[model samples]
Target: MKLSIERAALLRAVARAQSVVERRNTIPILANVLIEAEGDEIKFRATDLDIEVVDNAPAKVERAGSSTVNAVTFHEIVRKLPDGALVSLTDDGASGRLNVEAGRSSFALATLPRQDFPVMATSEYDSTFTAPAPVLRRLFDKSKFAISTEETRYYLNGVYMHVADAEGRQVLRCVATDGHRLARIDAELPEGAEGMPGVIVPRKAVGELRKLLEDDEMKIEVSVSETKIRFATPEITLTSKVIDGTFPDYSRVIPQGNSRKLEVDASDFARAVDRVATVSSERSRAVKMQLDEDRLILSVNAPDAGNAEEELVVAYADEKLEIGFNAKYLLEIASQVDRENAVFLFNSSGDPTLMREGDDTSAVYVVMPMRV
Candidate 1:
């Protein structure tokens, strides 16, 4: 097989393909991306057994055939090639090695059988729908930061995507909970999605799917089944196995009747939470919040370290309240508020509190309180 591709075009495709290749490999071909040339195009495919990605780019195809090469080594070689130079990749049908050539640079990669690469199985999808890129972006972007890293629960390690009624309107919803904090987001449902099954899209799929949804105006075609889910654009189709576990019933954890209300500027509150947390040790990140008529005092005290305190003017006029929360959790939830003020609802010193974006129900959050 032989093909000539410009250095920039070759490097962009190889960089994307190699980033998916892991550093350690027990299987030889798992570290390679199969390259094939036919017509005027060349295709590059890479996989780690569970996930596979293929990129097809226009090239000067010659000799029309396929070969496998090390993804990292080939990418490193192409990256060093001089700008505007023409790169030619060639391998005899049975040489067992692929030769790369530029103006004055040369390298050979050991080739493997292209037929040995594993591809994901295709399935009959139970549902298909389309959503705007930004709609899907907000669904995952706002909630992914709260995804649990704990492997024991496995189910909580991903954002739960499903259809639910929000404020008397049918909306596509995403919910993620780590038992201590939860993010619930609602977006308008697309057509033909009324019967979509609730699927717990895994963490890695959520990340891979994010790259395809960057264009704010692009419409994404999504397919779902009992065991697998697929997301596609005109140029890319991604299919992955869904986690085979039931997502916990998250609605019961959402607080409803918290009466004490505190309204403060979101940026001011986040800065105060961060500034006071400087004195906290890793294990104990509890930040004590003292609320009076219209003043909020944020303080942190660690015996081994020093102490920190900051004050913020808020709109709280309820009875005096003192509460403690994990500094990290507070900072995360506060960053979700896009508006100027973040409204927090409290019940008592020991109850889960509710947070929302300035009276908007579309995006709401809940956090369990911690003892100081």
Candidate 2:
């Protein structure tokens, strides 16, 4: 394949495509990015057999052909090219090398047959809908932190996305949990997404999708099927297989009867938790919260590392409540509160507690308490 593309445009396309290519691959061809040049555009495709990302950039085509080369190497070469310089890529099928040239720099990358690259098969989507980039970004960004990393419970290793009833309205929802903490976020359902099948978007796919949502004005087209899910923008398309498992019913995990209320500044609360946690042991980072009237005190005691306590004036009017929680969990959950103070509802020191930003029920978090 032979084509000339602007350095900035080429690097952006290749960088997005190659980010999914794993450096170490059992199959050599899996490490290569497929380059196809035709008409007035060039396409860069890379996959790890599970997730495939294809990006297209406008180019001046010299010859219509295709070639495969190391995704990482090609990305690095294009990245180092001077800004505004035109880059030329030529493939000598006979020599099995792809030549890259920009200004005074030139290098040839070993090539593989384009036929050896494994492209993920397409699927008949059950539902397809469009959403504002910022809406999708909030849904995934708020809940992804709780996705489980345990390989055994594969179902919990991704964000569970589906349609559900919220406050008598059907809303699109994303839920994720690692058994210790759970996050549930809801957005208004799109017109064509009523029949969308529930799918567990794998952890890696969630991360890849985040990069595409940086542009708030961009509209994303999302397609979902029983086996696969695809997110597409004008210049790029990302496709991945949905985890083949059933997500457990997570409704029971969200505490409903917890009524002891405590409202505290989210940022201040997070900072206080961090300071107290500094004295906590690495293994069990437990922080005790004492609440009475309008006062809240956070304390941590580690046998070998010493102890710390900090008092903060908060809005708590219920009977005195004391609870212990994993310091890290409290900090993470508190950070999600963006607009208003974080409101914490407690059932007891032993039951799961609910937290949310101000009075917004759209996004709710549940955390199981730990014994101090």
Which has the greatest lDDT? 2
Among all candidates shown, the one with the greatest TM-score: 2
TM-score for every candidate vs. truth? 0.94, 0.99
Error of 2 at 225 (Å): 0.2
Kindly list the per-residue Cα lDDT of model 2 for residues 1-372, writing each as its tens digit: 788999999999999999999988889999899999999999999998889999999999989899999999889888888899999999868889999999999998899988888889889999999999999999999999899999999999999999999999999999999999999999999989999999999999999999899998999999999999999999999999999999999999998899999999999999999998998667358899999999999999998889999999999999988899999888888888887699999989999999999999999999999987
Looking at model 1, residue 372 earns an lDDT score of 90
Which tens-of-lDDT digit does each residue in 63-87 have in candidate 1? 8999989999998888888999899
Each candidate structure's count of clashing pairs: 0, 0
- After best superposition, candidate 2 residue 30: deviation in angstroms? 0.8
Count of backbone collisions in candidate 2: 0
State the displacement of the C-alpha of residue 154, model 1, in Å, after optimal TM-score superposition: 0.8
Task: Tell me the deviation in Å of residue 341 in model 1.
Answer: 1.7
